[model samples]
Target: MALPLVLFDVNGTLSDMGRMTQHVEEIGAPPQLAGLWFATVLRDGFALTAAGENPAFRAVAEGALRVVLAGQVLNRDVDDAVAHILTAMQQLPVHPDVADGIRGLTAAGFELAALTNGAATTASGLLERAGVRDAFAAVLSVEDGPGWKPAAGAYTHALAALGRGADDVVLVAAHPWDIDGASRAGLRTAWLNRDASPYPSAMVPPDHEVAQLGDLLSALRT
Candidate 1:
């Protein structure tokens, strides 16, 4: 059989979100609040998509951060902190396990690609900075399909770019919603359960579950 293509989610699945949190803390804002605000950006972005609107993820992140900052007393250089966060998103540090596992998977001959909620250029840049850009046959974004994730079309866009059928692709993500969305779009899914939660009753269980990308090699090999 032809090896199945493996697609990965970029943001939380591969990048360490600590950069955003640390940047805000240095600017005298609560670290957790910064993380919460960053998360709210994604929530609101997805909500807009669900409501038939499409907004840039960067815009949403900045808008949400500003709202959270409006209620707080910030004394340090706030704009610089926000800039750092945005740049961090563009040059995300890979999760410690990502680089090795991706290299291993590539060496094993599986075609690889990245599917992200960020813009196309942003995804390409981040993957380059993380030193794994060469492993991906393609880097895709929800922007390519004119909508955000869980929309079916987003995964469709990615699979189309890779010249692969949905069933021959395995979408890997840390978020349950991402996995569910990819599955709904007809791709096989592997849940990278960094947090190890049980699946909800209605959400389909992933084809395979692994705590880290390193574990994925053996699972996929089978």
Candidate 2:
């Protein structure tokens, strides 16, 4: 049998997004406030896309950061702070389990790839730094498609790139929305439930769930 293709989400699935909030806190900003800024970035990114605008993910993220920092009425200038934050983001560290889990999956004969809403540069840089870029057969971004995901086409394009259909692929992600979107596109779903959070009731149940990526490969043993 051809091993099931493994498609991963880049951000929360592979990397630790909470670190960005903690990074801002290290600079004397409140962690919750930093989270708010990060949330705004996601909101704006989707809005721009739905509006038929093609703002780069980095630019949308920076704009959201500007608005977030300015909202507090602090003396700090938003533009400079945004620049610092962007650079800091590029340097954000990955979770310790990421590299090993990826290696395990590869060793298990899974054809690996990534499908991310993030810019290709940002996603590749993170994986390269984590020393697992070589494990993936492909790394794709939504920029080449109509928009970022929650749109079925994002997952559709990703599966197409792998030259596989829904039955041959499994979409793994930490986000419920991403899982829902992938499922809607007819791919088997795996929820990397790192947070132990409950799944959303409105969505279809995933084919698999695991608290850690290390457990994921083991669970998928054929």
Candidate with top lDDT is 1
**Please, what are the lDDT tens digits per residue for candidate 1 over residues 119-211?**
878778777887889998888888768688878878888777888999999999988888888888899999998767787778767899999
Q: Give TM per candidate.
A: 0.93, 0.92
Give candidate 1's error at residue 160 in angstroms: 1.7
lDDT of 2 by residue, 26-137 (tens): 4556678777876787788777767776567788887787777764544356565667778888876678789999999988888899988888888899999999999999
Q: What's the CA RMSD for each of the models? A: 1.7, 1.8
Query: Residue 94 error for model 1, in Å?
Result: 0.3
